[model samples]
Target: MKKSIALFIILISVFSLAFNSCSSDDDESNDPQVATGSFEIYLDGVLFKQGTNAEVGLIKDNQGNYVNTVTIGMGSETGIVVSGFPATISDVTTMDNDSDPGVNINVDSDYYGTISGTMTRTSASKISFDGTCTKLMEAQVYTITGFVQSTAWEVID
Candidate 1:
């Protein structure tokens, strides 16, 4: 009777361990990453600005293409604007600068450049992008690198 009781206790312990090992916590880490309405900009390999606010405007055309405009750090001196590019993305489309020349960048109303990299629509209301901007200011060339993950977007008529 003592040996049977010990064996029963051991089995229960094993079962408990097995149940706890397959928890939902492990599945949480496997979930897909989403945007959190934040962005970072680097100028010439140096940290320029970091912000937690973003605005995105999206418009869909008759042909089912999506046009998006994004603004980060709005109303601040260290702002960035992206327009005309990512012009044909859908809910899950990814586009690069090579295929889309319509992407323009304006920084602080002073630096102007064109974007070169990739922009992806992670969801219907979110986008993630990493790009380099070759800015020209007074005949001087500067490099600006940025990454944006916006949490929400508005559909425009």
Candidate 2:
């Protein structure tokens, strides 16, 4: 009887140790990565400024769904950011000043207006957007066009 009890305890200990072992592969796979992209801003059909390294991220909406966001520039500097939650490929997502939907492109420059664009996924890790923005600020009318591409966007939040 004592021998059988000892054998059962040994088995239980071995099982516990096996279950508690940590796997590096599993841990690394679960980690989130940052998304990156690039864009060029054109003012009145002329190239005004551009960014080679932009940051793209995923944001969760109230419905617990993921939305893709593209952001460029800094807090104090001229910046342009847009968010689109495309359900499928080639879906045109739009953002405007009056609409103010969560999924909209926001221009934070001296000129701010309605930015309408479409986001297309070219590959599993790449995306491209073509859009036009028109804004009238300080009695000056500005028309801008943007061509943006994702350089590196494969992050999970």
Candidate 3:
């Protein structure tokens, strides 16, 4: 009878250990989360503002190098796209204007420009830009400043 009781207790203990080891709370997802944020940019005195329509994440460039990008109003005709950033940014990183342009401003999908200024990574999920864009064809220039705060960064292929 004692052996039977000991065997039953052992079985119960094993079952308890197995159940505890498979806890749902301890199972964390390894997938990259989608980013969410808002941004506003003033182009030639015209204001373009979007709420919850911004995404900041890491994407691979043409050379397969990881670069940081912030896209606002992605699906809309008028938006702002800033890319060519290093995989990791410092307090205030200047925008590069070499062969690989760093910033692209799309106004009504008509005007495109390159930015000359600095980008600040305030936090892990927040970034701010302060600079000016020079229109491609025209000699027009305007101030472009904005900030994006996202819950997380979405890693894009």
Which candidate gets the maximum TM-score versus the true structure? 3
Write the residue-wise lDDT of candidate 1 on 23-76 in tens digits. Answer: 345454322211125667666778766777443333335695534554444333
Error of 2 at 128 (Å): 5.4
* Model 3 ranges with Cα > 4 A deviation: 1-33, 44-46, 55-58, 61-66, 86-90, 98-101, 154-157
- Full-model lDDT for every candidate: 0.44, 0.44, 0.51
In the predicted model 2, the residue pairs found to clash are: none
Please identify model 1 stretches exceeding 4 Å from their true place: 1-36, 54-66, 84-109, 122-131, 154-157
Looking at candidate 2, what is the lDDT of residue 43? 66
Give the better candidate number (1 or 3) by lDDT. Answer: 3
In model 2, the Cα lDDT at residue 127 comes to 48
What's the TM-score of every candidate structure?
A: 0.46, 0.51, 0.58
Regions of model 2 farther than 4 Å from truth: 1-33, 62-64, 74-76, 94-111, 115-136, 151-157
Which residue pairs collide in model 1, if any? none
Report clashes for each candidate as comma-separated counts: 0, 0, 0
Please estimate how well model 1 matches the true structure, expressed as its whole-model Cα lDDT: 0.44
Give per-model CA RMSD.
Answer: 22.9, 19.6, 21.3
Q: Against the true structure, whose lDDT is highest?
A: 3
